[model samples]
Target chain A: MKFSARNVFRGKVKSLKKGPVNSEVTIEMPGGLEMVATVTTQSAENMGLAEGAETTALIKATQVMLVSE
Target chain B: MKFSARNVFRGKVKSLKKGPVNSEVTIEMPGGLEMVATVTTQSAENMGLAEGAETTALIKATQVMLVSE
Candidate 1:
């Protein structure tokens, strides 16, 4: 599925770490850029997001307001 | 934002009914079609989805499997 969000990044699942509350999935973009997101375990399982899996990280442009260095 | 999902429907909020746990928001599409979705009240308020508001209902094509009448 192609999402229309302005900041669509095609990435590969670098790692999957399960936490007590939520799972932290990291995606590595083509240019060595990385994005970390928290999602429900069920969603992770449903999406079949695993290491080396190709996926798109979707975030509403508005939702991605700021970045802290 | 334009989404690239296979099924994209432009819809308007017809009604916003709040439940104790979740909110039931009904969206009316352009061709007199309607889709009912359940979302958290916080998400609704965050998205500013009020009656008469224009919004896009996003669901992964795979997520929308089938409908049984």
Candidate 2:
């Protein structure tokens, strides 16, 4: 399905830390840039996410925040 | 405040498009990479965001999704 998230990166699953409700999945990009995402444990299981699996990280534009620095 | 989101990039406001309820903001990074974000019009006004303004983009890990391709 097409997503409205502007930031989409292709990466490989580097690690998976599952909890009761949520799971933390780390995806390593081509340049070794790791993106950390927190997803529901059910979704993770549904996706059958595992180490070395190819995946794409999706972040919605509305979910993004701009901070003055 | 420190954020839990792993992906954080410093950029300058490239453009701003405002609607009745939401506003679309585009920030340009140092290397010309642009990140788009959708925020509430109230927030845009509260932050006093304008063109050429420097800012940081924040995204929560929980808000990120993983898609298998």
Candidate 3:
């Protein structure tokens, strides 16, 4: 699929935790860099996300915040 | 709009820089929080991203990385 976001990472699904409205998904990238994604339960179900499944984490730079003290 | 991904932040557009293929957008959130987003020039144009424009930065948790040192 074509997307406008510049940051995309390949990952493997590590775990899935269901919430009321969203489901928390853990994705393990290379070098053990793990990321979490909260998606709608429907979306999670549609993607068939499960343990050991391969997926991608698409990110927009605007979504990232940097803090310095 | 119905998006499967969770994590949304409301902000005003701080700046928009056009690149060869992609455009960099800076968004300022509440309480001085700022975030940067890189999108395709076409996408930028489609979204009408510009200075002072209000926008929402949609992020999936899977897109965020954490490091503990």
Candidate 3, residues A1-69, lDDT tens digits: the string is 344566778899999999877888999999999999878887888778889988988776567899999
Q: Which residue pairs overlap in candidate 2's backbone? A: none
Stretches > 4 Å off in candidate 3: B1-69
Docking quality category of candidate 2 according to DockQ thresholds: medium
The order of the candidates by lDDT, greatest first, is: 2, 3, 1
Model 2 local distance difference test score: 0.86
By summed lDDT, the worst window of 10 consecutive residues in model 1 chain A runs over: A1-10
lDDT of 2 at A43: 93
Query: TM-score winner among the candidates?
Result: 2
Instruction: Compute the lDDT for candidate 1.
Output: 0.74
- How high is the DockQ of candidate 3? 0.22
**Reproduced native contacts, each prediction:** 0.00, 0.82, 0.43
lDDT, residue A11, model 3: 90
Residue B8 in model 3: lDDT:
72
Question: Which is better, 1 or 3, measured by DockQ?
Answer: 3
Taking the tens digit of each residue's C-alpha lDDT, what string does model 3 give over B1-69? Answer: 334565778899999999988888999999999999878897788777779988888776557899998
lDDT of 3 at A59: 72
Model 1, residue pairs in steric clash: A2-B4, A4-B2, A4-B3, A4-B4
lDDT of each: 0.74, 0.86, 0.82
Better of 1 and 2 by DockQ: 2
TM-score of each: 0.51, 0.78, 0.54
